[model samples]
Target: MAEHAEAEHEEEAEPRPKRAPIDWRRGREQAFSILASIVRWVGLIFAALLVLHVIFVIGSANSANGIVSFVRGWADGLSLGFKDLFTPSDAKLRVLVNYGIAAIFWLIVSGILARIIRRIGGVVSS
Candidate 1:
């Protein structure tokens, strides 16, 4: 009985094998975090440009001013594909078409990219 008890004690004292470390998952998580931050910043920039464009259009910001011209140029360049899709018959309509569409487009694309990134991260971690 003492020998059996000693064997049992020895077994209990021995440590179990360690779990497989998740080194790859940690690396993937960090990379995904950095990517998400960059995407968010880009989205914010696009939204800002669209908002500034709307303000310029609605308030009739003077194109002669350097700041106004710069904002308009940036907005135009960023929203190149979505521009003039709808014929703006008036000033208010123009603002809606030129700025609203770009803002919505950026928001939707950003959201989709974020979701995709999250899904990929989850899959990699799992």
Candidate 2:
């Protein structure tokens, strides 16, 4: 009876299964996800900067101020030539429309690029 019990205990002590090797395809998918997130965040930041600049202009913030100047410089560069796309008689309205359109453009372009990247990653995984 004792020998039978010992044999049963030994049988129950089987080794755990070995872990599988890391999958490079999964790593590629993760890399693509990270890239997409970065693109999305960059676009969001650009849009935010443009909107902030618009707010500063409409609120008549001092152009000579350091913060205003910095934001203005960045916003101008990110405007993609849309800064002066319209020539409304009212300066405020012009900024509103042009910068607004530029902001929307960034958002849309980023979203599309992110989606495409994710799709490519999915295809590679499959």
Candidate 3:
């Protein structure tokens, strides 16, 4: 019985798990490509929009008012939880508050998108 116990122990010790070697080069390449594509597309779209905005602004002074109206609606959502940025009130505070809220929201969105892209990169690499 003692010999049988020793044999079992020896067999268990001898059958170690064999791990496959990791290929770092291929993993790195996949990660790099995923991030590069995301950055390229995002930058191209942002640049195109900015250029169009600049052209519109230069074409006519009246277009400036349109830009202001656009911000007051879409960009104003961030301030819903906060106090009136503009009362008959402080015009400067209102502008600052609006911009501050927009900036915070933009940062949060950008961070989440970046993390998602990075995770996708890891998945593709694997």
Please name the candidate that would achieve the greatest TM-score relative to the true structure. Answer: 2
Looking at candidate 1, the ten consecutive residues that score lowest on lDDT are 91-100
For model 3, residues 79-101, the per-residue Cα lDDT tens digits are: 34432544535554554554454
Overall local distance difference test of candidate 2: 0.93
Tell me the tens digit of each residue's lDDT in model 1 across 1-126. 999999999999999999987788888887887787678779878988888888888888788999999888888887867778777689667776867789888877887887788778878887
- After superposing candidate 1 on the true structure, give the runs of residues whose Cα lies further than 4 Å from its correct spot: 1-22
The lDDT per prediction is 0.82, 0.93, 0.54
| Model 2 worst lDDT run, 10 consecutive residues | 117-126
| TM-score versus the correct structure, for each prediction | 0.74, 0.83, 0.37
Q: Relative to the unseen true structure, what is the C-alpha lDDT of residue 46 in candidate 2, on a scale of 0 to 100?
A: 93
Clash-forming residue pairs, model 1: none
What is candidate 2's CA lDDT for residue 56?
A: 95
**How do these models rank on TM-score, best leading?**
2, 1, 3
Off by over 4 Å in 2: 1-19
Candidate 3 similarity to native, TM-score: 0.37
